[model samples]
Target: MDLVNHLEGRLLFAVPKKGRLNATALNLLEGADIQFRRENRLDIALVKNLPIALVFLPAADIPTFVGEGQCDLGITGFDQVAEHDARRRAIARDQAESGKSTPVEGAPAKGCEQVLDLDFGACKLQVQVPVKGKYRTPADLIGKNIGTSFVSLAAEYFAKLEAEADAANGEAPGAKPLRTKIIELSGSVEAACALGVADGIVDLVESGETMKAAGLEAIDTVISTKAILIKSKNPSNKTLVDLIASRIQGVISAQQYVLCQYNVERKNLDAVCKVTPGRRAATINALEEEGWVAVSSMVEKKRIATVMDELSKLGAEDILVVGILNTPKPDELSEELLNANTMSSPQPSPPTQRRSSSPPQQQEKESSLSRLVIAPLTFISFLLSLFLVDTYTTSSRRRDRGPRSRGSWLSALLWRQKPGSPY
Candidate 1:
């Protein structure tokens, strides 16, 4: 069977073949229930349940494949995406200047769009120099050699700095333009400074431990990055792409939140609702015993302890925090499942709504009557206060009888004075 023909109808999902992101990306796919099996030494794995083929590629290369429309979706670092985008723009600029095709052959003009942040593989791309070296700041390393695997990103960073420096100098005579040389290295970028190959290096810093071991200290951070999902601007099968994105999002949400259930008295339900308001609304069901209700909500795992304490303070009992293995978004649930849930579970009334003894029409009438009575009384009170202030001001004026004794504005409005009478 021809490889291209076999993969023709399937969505191409690119992922990290090795390194820090590989295992985590695989785990995410598993969490999303995307089962797959790859043959030994094979780079591609066909999904057992979906029309998707997972293409294992280098993290750096995944962005390029996705951006060029060779792959429909991919998982890679935001730093890699930035680097690839920078290179793509530079190439497009060169092609434009040369009056050639704006887009290179086999590469689309449109690039990949970030769909979701995976939140793993968090790190910073930073400019680092030797601890005892003369270079302390990024400015000190200007016009010097900087080694990095991200050549485009390093170049772009220096270009911006050089432009800013030039603008600051403002056409000063004999002022040379700052030009930092970027040395592209495939690996071992941290050792570039000690090896005498570069004055400084631009690399990813996770814990700063490796940089410390390398006798390096970061001076400037270029970009903070984490693993993110990206898809082509114009995907061949948008439905399949969206479905995959939804599944991944469900997995991410499951990891973030846990189900918290508790029983609370009806009187305290409102106060407890404020604590665990949940993603949209909390689920409340009437208990067997009167004046008690069972409440369930999704609480963030990081703040679960604080939430439970808050519930306890609000007189909630029988609190339980349950881990969620998987949680699909409400909209993503099938009609059958939604209908079943609707039938099995009682509809939850909003916590904020309270039972009123008076009917809505009676309540409206009472509100209107109160407003009518209060409006006139409030106006009368205001007038009385103004009269009292005016009287006090007049008495003070009569006692002082000075040229600067100007009557209060309210007194002037309340009384008209004769031309020659200081009354």
Candidate 2:
């Protein structure tokens, strides 16, 4: 089936609606000129130029929505995707009944197929504690109340840690009676430790700004995350899906690096080319100066300053770094993206015939019902919340702009005045 067939004649794209993720998601789409208009009553957004609908959702909830087939595509952090196991659960079920039954024991789950790695949303999930604490390893987190937005991921990691601990103790590993509590926090996870709510936090660290401000220090890195594009379990339209995916990939490629140009002596052309990696930079035209060759190339944004300094030191002249809007370079990104797309296009597995060592009938029935019915409901609620935010935001703006009472006006005027200024 095609994308139009799956998404009710509309190619559905899901993005985080608010906060840091929302800003980055919208910026990425805008960079590609994929503008969207939101409906007042529904959570669905209509893409003006493309045959698509955009759904604004929380970054953490995107995986479940995509896995449940509520959306054809989504952009979210790799950490949230891994923590929720939303993709893994879907892939596990898919592999369980694809005839060949590709074992999902250690492989990626079929919940969401990664399309591309968005370079933004760079963060590491680190184990953090008070700056003066003695904790130095994952072992210190054992039997400690850990606060995190990534409850499932924390649990999985801790379980592994406990198993290792048990093996060292010469005991068979199984469920233990550990007293540690896994508190699932919505936000302000770092503050939990300062406020004495938890002993430590498992949270995303960008530049360690928030952690430093809160007097916390990272002790161990659990995982590093970047933004990724994910596709639905049973994509309705392949053409639309591939087209959208390609466009997104192009946008990401354009954002990561700038095109550099310069002039160099023909004798030094080989050396200049070697300095400009990605092989994207090439010789263009020659100057009036004999043996002077003009060169053009692509350099990663982070390396631009360093490349410029190096080129200048090496006698390269007029080295200009121009921002790239878009390019058709297919070899820019890793082959992992292409591999992901190819592997994820197949149909998902049906509920039954998924496991060789199946659970008892009642257990299987419950599992199927939860996976097929309740899981979708949870995802639906998340999708609806995206729309609800738009409704609330519109209503809020209207109320804020309405006429205010005399007392309210007085408060506003007083609050806007300088602290020490006379009336």
Candidate 3:
């Protein structure tokens, strides 16, 4: 079936089917209350209660599909995003060179846009040296064999290092920069050096355990890697995309927090409020016991024990910590999403301007009067436009071939008989 025809009006969300980030990714959706089930062999699934089809794909391939417009949204790693971004930048430069169209100064080079970091699958892409080797830094690996799965990113990293190294030594402007041989390996990059396949290795390290087991130590960190959500460079349904992304953020918050409910004397209200200040202020309710109140709030799951101890010390009673299934809509963001132009730093908001001294009541009255009058005016304008269009259409139809009965005209267009075939 044709893609557009089969999934019309549904947003495509590309997801990693299996990998280090897979479990976390699936848990995120489930926490967001997006129910879905994929067949044993099928890679696509429809999310219940939303016009979204989840496409299971290799994490590495997600960026390509999203960038190419084959998928509308994606969730993948920061390393993948950076790699694809480099490719996009190259493509934009090429397009500019061809004089086809000038790429925007800070627009995403590829068609994929970085929506925001979903805050899971955290790791580091690093250059590691054998524990007993002489190589100590990226500088030592110049012109040496470096093995890894992330060939493009490692190459880009080394290219910059080589450039800086030559520039520092005052090499000629056009001199050939010292480069490293990037030996690509699908897995077991830690074993590359021992096997003599390469002198050093560049790969992702979550805890440095694997590299340590193989007697390797990371010397240089190229970049930190984490799971992130991405959207089309130009989204057709921006509102829907943001809503979905926001829900994912909410799920992250829900997992990290727990609802804490407790009872406390009214005399200790001020102190209790200071202890468990939910997202804003703790909810307080009147209890049957005189001078007593019920306090409910959200507290970080990791800090629950300490928080509970603090509350207990304050003479609080019946404290309970309830795990949250999901937050649904988060008031606080776990991480900021990077936009299309690759903004690494946030822009400061402009200072507020002073408003006029006029009373708010006066302003509200004027706004209400304007709205009341604007409605009828708008309705009249709409009616006038319709009348003019109908009149023009009727006049044109009569002038072209004279007017016919309305039923006859409709039947002739819908059920017209052709000479070549039976009706």
Candidate 4:
């Protein structure tokens, strides 16, 4: 079993425990071949192969866990990281004013920073109203209560809206005090207004299906968000953190495409190659036919059919699209790995910046737990396939004795397998 030793200071990666975030995160991790097997009711999963521990938790809590250094790294939504930053800034200021250190360990020794945009769990935090609300622009929400889970972000957006509204009235922007009240809600933020709790809402819009079903429409977007990899304001485990991040980038690249190769006439090569400009195509001489060349290139699956049709139109014959299980070049994975690790040394902490945010581990021995399980199960399956092949080949074959008393090849082989008796 491939496993990692339970060292006291091993890296902990916090990810969403459930919901859309959980599935996407798992898929991304698996694509990287990080090797993990999940079990029911387990919050922590130790990677069988790497010195890493994964802690599953609510998506909203990832920032908190990593911010306080309970985790060395976290995968969370950009919105949550922004929210945490706003809150942390506020708390850090309070800590500085009192001449006491923040209780939150790992609270970016500097300040909050967003590391990687994971490109999953995409959604928009938007301001929405009933489908036909007369309030069309930012000015319409003046003095209205806006329901939102992201009070900090919503407040910031509305404040900007108030300035714009003021400017439209021939007043200087930022000259008027914003009258919009941001009502924070834990859930069902959209229903709040339809249920008469607020005039508008700022909440995540995924596919716009739910909002449309609820008889609401997005009017203005506060921010679009996706999962992001975050680290301590000043991370301690820069090398390990970078390694995981690069693996993530590699996995993403791997899922994207395959290389294709085929032979075509030289006269039609230009037309065919034009259809795949973004691809790094190569040409080689064809031995089978005069004035023919073999072409190989990378093409996205989604674009292959269209490009193939275009190639056909251009007179390229004998076209073939081969599936690629892997590609070694342009090494996106290798680049990510190198970049993540060889960056700068730790910098000194930035000056304390404070505002307002009010909110709320253990060096366990490096558990020799494998980050992955069931790998042996795969090897077993391979062995079984091998044995089946051998058995099938042996059973299906027959030995022949020509120009002599007929004897099957199998009979001869079996005779060889027998003890001292000769046939």
Q: Estimate the TM-score of every prediction.
A: 0.76, 0.65, 0.71, 0.67
Q: Which stretches of candidate 2 lie over 4 Å from their true place?
A: 1-7, 39-42, 86-110, 132-136, 174-179, 194-196, 277-281, 285-292, 305-319, 332-423
Q: Which of the numbered candidates is closest to the native, going by highest TM-score?
A: 1
Compose the digit string of candidate 3's lDDT tens values, residues 1-423.
Answer: 233455777889999999898998998888677788876777888877888889999998899999888788999998988877766665665577778875369764446878778878999998999999998887999999999888778877888888888889997555353378988798888899999999999889998899899999989899998999998876657788988888887777666877777778889999988988887667776664557777778788899999999999999977766666556554652211111112223432212222222355776788898799987899999998887676656644654585434434534454445587533
Report, for every candidate in turn, its global Cα lDDT versus the true structure: 0.84, 0.73, 0.77, 0.68
| Clash count, one per candidate | 0, 9, 1, 18
Ranking by lDDT: 1, 3, 2, 4
Error of 3 at 222 (Å): 1.1
Candidate number of the best lDDT: 1
Q: What's the true lDDT of residue 341 in model 2?
A: 26
Q: Which ten residues in a row have the lowest lDDT in candidate 3?
A: 335-344
> For residues 322-349, could you state the per-residue lDDT of candidate 1 as single tens digits?
6666666744442222222222234333
Worst 10 residues of 1 by lDDT: 335-344
Q: Comparing candidate 1 with candidate 2, which one achieves the higher TM-score?
A: 1
**Superposed Cα RMSD, model 1:** 28.5
The global Cα lDDT (0 to 1) of model 3 is 0.77
Error of 3 at 169 (Å): 1.7
